[model samples]
Target chain A: MQSFALYPFAPPGDVAALRADLRAWLAEHQPHDDVVKRANCWASFDPDFSRALGAAGYVGMTLPAIYGGGDRHPLERYVVIEELLAAGAPVGAHWIADRQTGPLILRYGSEEQRERYLPGIAKGELYACIGLSEPGAGSDLAAVRTSARETAEGWRINGQKIWTTGAHFSHIMLALVRTEGGSERNAGLSQLLIDLDTPGITIRPIIDMAGNHDFNEVFFDDALVPHGALVGTRGQGWKQVTAELGLERSGPERYLSSHALLIALIDAAGADPEPAIAGLIGKLTAEMWTLRQLSMSTAAKLAAGEDPMVEASVVKELGNAFEQDMPRRVRAIVDCAWDDDADLARLLRALLIASPSFSLRGGTREVIRGIIARGLGLR
Target chain B: MSDARDMLCDTARAVLRGADDIAPVEEVGFALLLVAEGQGGVGGDWGDANAVLHIAGMLAPDIPVADVILSGLGDVSMPHRAAATVSLMAGAMGQALALSIDHVNTRQQFGRPLGKFQAVQQSLAVMACEVAAVDAAAAAMAARLDASGFDADAAVFEIAAAKLRANRAVGVVTSIAHQVHGAIGFTEEYDLRRVTIPLMRWRGEHGNDARWAQALGRQVASFGGRGLWENLTARAG
Candidate 1:
């Protein structure tokens, strides 16, 4: 495996060009009209905004051009994502589809599946959510009790998924479930692509403490799907899902969740804030800068058709610590209250509420640390 | 292909592995990796220099690697030394972290190894994180040097960041290593002080985090947010 470079190379010329074009478009399309709403950033779901982004060809840059994508490098997509997250753009609606689902389908889905889903995904008309975590399976996804049995016409999925973000608004779900029986846990698992509107499916919203309807508990009771719905090979779901999980962890989203708060911190600190506060800002910014470079390097490896599982996990674990730590540091430095009317206060409150989930989502801290230790051969 | 660089690194590592001294490395011209080909030295890229610096740092040699390498480049200033110091300290911190990990795992307390304790593991984890960050900062600075070729003006902000971040890491890494090793780490007999003391000395050399932070603040304030951001995201041109 290649080690992290002392100085990773720069993004390609097209990446910078695309970033400029996106910045200009954002300047006109997304202003700071509502600071609180913008604070939601990638978490803010807006179908119309997603459609606009799709029309501008910003969503699916890494997919094949024949499938309605830009056929660009992964770093190009990375540049767009970094800009969107930095400016706190409303990208939740198309984020999952653009990030992983489109690539997953392109890589693992059959011809019919790719033809049917890829175009819509590129156009941002389709939305999707992951179905790995169940009520009993948060981090231990292999323990998913969601079993799918072979039926006369197709497969019948009878189980439930929890913390399925955007499932309520999503059009499809690439669900992980058991297709085989007996003692082996991972060997029995498989993935099924089920349309959200299937008759036996139910999606209920779970409001976060931030009072945001961002999570959902999805129930699938004998939800029937055609044989074509299986992604990749049966009994290979564990391998496929773990491979894609690397994609999930390799984005700017991992660290940029609370970027808006940091910017607000700088603005609120004024020209001559206390030296201690100024030092804090510099430290946070420096950490962010280094992490961004690290993330970009991970993307470069992905583009070269390499699996950066360990490096990707490192970025996620470190990024999560920084994002979760930023709010506490800001609060400690500047005494502030949660005033809905105050911009900085609102942003701070939003970050504080959202911080707990930083390490919990994707993979929890313990799970990630274990992975890092394993990567280092310590385990 | 970096064959020469790799050879140099392997040679330096072999020479320094258990030497307990830096004299052998200097005698072999290993410290001349960055001293320019025309200057009666082995001219290599920042990457090569970094490899040598990492080895020299792990040993915490009595003979100065940064001063030897930087001084050879003619009129060496504090800022230049500061940049090199950051990379050098990162190497030392990395060595210290590895030593601490080994000590806690091997040396037992309360009928069990200290690393088995959650509190000890947590402290070690924190130390590991700082070491990684310092390593990254050093790499980033080396990359800048590779692109801009020691153009001090182009690298001022980054050099400040590297030095400041590395200086901070030295503080955390040294203290945590001491904390983990307990009494043995403080004594002269143990090898822990070899790296920790170098970290302590390097923390104040060139310029510490506070000094670099002041410079960084002035740069940010002068440029404003937009300019600072442009600087931050500016790719190698």
Candidate 2:
């Protein structure tokens, strides 16, 4: 948990080299399909590409060496993730474990857990999913009714986890469950690592409004696990969960989602741009700069082992709002009628379909604003 | 990173903020821009000197003789337009920056400094960047005042951009200042009252930044992908 330095953040040095390399790699792996399938450039579960990336030593990039990680810079991993996302790499296979789960396990897991789990993650041999939100609880996280009870052998897990992305393909679900009951909420909560392949554990795909199978309705009916499956102390889940959420909340991926569309819109808008277009680009560009600073600052803080939960949420909430607004503004400003099946336009349409869940998935705007206000001591 | 301008600006700041003889401050801030050696102004490119303009505006918001002089700004070519008003706007911005900092530094929130809040700090950072960039851009444009001066319309765009970012920065900064000062910032007798009122007037006095950016973007993009960034970089470097 040692802190890292905030280096100069402009064009030059390793940063520039990394940018060039990433761009070249992206060009080679451009999704060849005629129609944009999932707007997630890395939409397909391509084990070959995953292993290729892992072989190239790009996986588990932020973890320490002892756990088989490449032990590179987290900021470097950030650049990598952003490059992949921007290039539309079908990174779904290795995304979850690489992003937060691997980092989480690296930080808080037991030696056995780290040795067993980290290597596979590094090679993209294993995929992981976060199982936090349940159907009933929504943003009221402490109200999660998923329960785990101690047994002679180990622990018995029950209840459901909804909107669990990649659970069908993932090997494990890092679940937040109630290990024990208390008079108040958040009393006996704990995080448990549940094997998705374990008997009685079911992952049913939840087709979203976009008609995509990225999400799942996971059910755990007496899923059995060893006592060692617990991520941390029983009641420490609240604290642990908050930290995990922070990782999920902060990153360039939170923004830059519709970057390709922005490029397309700019190209489509034709040569002599209207003043409105110029002004819009200028304003968005300004917001983009400010938000990038805010996000990277929070990440630097995190690398330094500081809990930037409030700041992370602020960045995510605002960044996503900007991202989600991008498509609408692009459509409004660029008047060409796009077929729902065209390349970039189709992708734009698909994103429009999925846009509602963008904010709701991470954390609702109200929840985030409340946190921002709390951070400011206004509420 | 530039040092001399900062030093000059530091001194200008002291005179404007610390020793304010009202009308004279405006006169001196405006006088510094008058190129000392050349026929026109050279202090325009010097950020530190531009700060003196801000000093003048804050010292005497009602009688902005400098503002009146720049108001004589008309009929410059497109490229030179940015520099012309910029050469003129430099002082007004100096006034705004000084006023913003003075107003916000004393402004309090939660019974402590208002600058303590992350939100407020973010706004201040933006204000600082706006003030600095406007100062530098004006300084750079002014250097070419005699040769390769921007066209008349460029002044409108340059002034628009400067005024837009500044206006937006001030709106944010002023709100925070008032919030920190609580009811005091809004009070007519408070030091911030004059500064805050003039912030709006100066912003509107010239073309807004948003209007200018849009106008420039329309011109540049429509004019065959013209990249004016290099122009900025050469001067900034």
Candidate 3:
């Protein structure tokens, strides 16, 4: 088997200056709130921060200028994303819209759809949630049974989408629904950009173990959306969603989500750490640095218009492992109590509880490994 | 990769294949790979060295290809040696992964290839991820070294991070490769050991995990938490 080569992550135009501007902006605007908020900061909902960030042109960066976007390169967007994630900025409000939905709409949505959503998304006011998982379609996404029937008025969507993150707050959902009758598995699926406020939709909170309501159970009972809501070709949702996932999985978020903990661990360790702490820090840093390289290369490949499905899966697998193991590894060598109130202890405790979903979300560990196996030419 | 690097890799692979020592590699004048063109040498960059060493690593694990390549620079530091070893380790780990994949796909178990088993596929998948990580690390480190003009001290952070990451991957790559290969991989005749044994050695050679980790950890601590991210982004792109 051939080994993976690092795709050159060359974002045109002064990247250092881009980073500097974002860093300076983040310094002025990012809320210095609870330390725990900084540790899974993407899930932290702060519309004001997201809007300010959008106003500053950090959101919807890769979209066309006609759509109120900055018309930046994808790698430029990648740099902005990595900076936002690393700083533990509260990016939840505009994360999905900017990351995937905006691009998906640009690439696959009709002109009217783009005209309706892109401006708001670029403005950071329109949030979107993915509707892929159902009660029966967690890992086997092809098992999705959410149906959207065609009508003269519009498409009527009827289904229950479980674990829909941001559905409670999102303005729209780019859902994968069965548009063809008797369609089974992956075929006959189509994407519909449903307005969340459509008459028959219901979004109820599904509180996580951390008592966080970042995700929800969104049920649609004949939720009527405009006929123009369909994204891309009919019966092509499977392919489109798969492509959207490429955007979802390999960004800096995969590894940088738990960056707050690393920062906490480092600050706690101080300049002169004991051998154990020092060793752990070193190992973690090495892994993080290596992961950044992999993630960036994958982003570069994506920017070059290549589908790095396997490469993206590799990043998610390794990045998930690193994020999950950090809390446990720190707990092993540190003398902090689980109930302690120190920033390190609290961050560790929060991450220990939240780590289980790190591998589960985006894609489960098994599914990601299977993707890697397929890339390896294994059945 | 540039045409020049591709041609260099071609020559390295041809000379190093099935060789018993570094003599053929020496005769091929690989020692001049990193020397300045004005100084009567090839004037190649670290990326060229990485590509060649990667080939040498796969073809001649027992050979001191890295040593000969470094000898071109007259005197090299520990970080430089560590950087070279990372590329070599990447090549060998990649070979181990390729051999393991080939074995599982061909070796039958319960009336089918072992690779047909989910257990085996998952194990190999994990091994592949580690191999991919090392390969990416080695390549990135090479880029950093090239950007820094082969100054070991200047590229110390990349060297420490890449070498340590590669060293840590040795366990996963070697164990999983042998695990998936079954008893046949344990034999000296198998091609797996040709790379695995060298990987195990290289993990501890220029700098062990603890040594590099401590050094890197100390450096990062000095950078502080925020400063670490700043320095990392600034140092590269």
Better of 1 and 2 by lDDT: 1
Cα lDDT listed for each candidate: 0.79, 0.62, 0.92
Q: How far off is residue A156 in model 1, in Å?
A: 0.5
- In Å, candidate 3's interface RMSD is 0.8
Best by lDDT: 3
Clashing residue pairs, backbone N/CA/C < 3 A, model 3: none
What ordering of candidates by lDDT runs from best to worst? 3, 1, 2
**Candidate 2: tens digits of C-alpha lDDT, residues A1-379:** 0011122223223755675676676567545643354354444577777877887777898777887798787777776776666555667788889888998887778888898899999998789998889988788888889989999999899899998888888998898899985524777888888788889888788788877788889998998999999986777888888888888888777776555555454454457666677776555544444455456666766776778776676677767777788777766765555665555577678767767877787788667755654453343
Lowest summed lDDT across 10 adjacent residues in model 1 chain A is found at A1-10
lDDT per residue (tens digit) for residues B40-136 in model 1: 7788877677767877788754557666677556766677788787777877887887888788778888999777776676566666667777777
Candidate 3 falls in which docking quality class? Answer: high
Per-model i-RMS: 3.3, 8.6, 0.8
Per-residue lDDT of candidate 3, residues A1-379 (tens digit)? 3466579999999999999899899889999979899888889899999889889998889999999999999999999989988999999989999999999999999999999999999989899999999999999999999899999999988889999999999999999999998999999999999888889999999999999898999989888998888899999999999999999998999999999999999999999988899899999999999999999999999999999898999999999999999999999999977799999999999999999999999989999888888888887
lDDT of 3: 0.92
Order of candidate numbers by DockQ, starting with the best? 3, 1, 2
| Deviation in Å, model 3, residue A374 alpha carbon | 0.6
Give each prediction's root-mean-square deviation over alpha carbons: 2.8, 7.9, 0.9
Per-residue alpha-carbon lDDT of model 3 for B97-214, expressed as tens digits?
Answer: 8898899889987999998888898898899889889988898899998898899998899999999999999999999999999899999898999999999999999999999999
lDDT of 1 by residue, A223-323 (tens): 88999999999999999999889999868888886777777777766677568867777777767777776777778777777887877877888889889
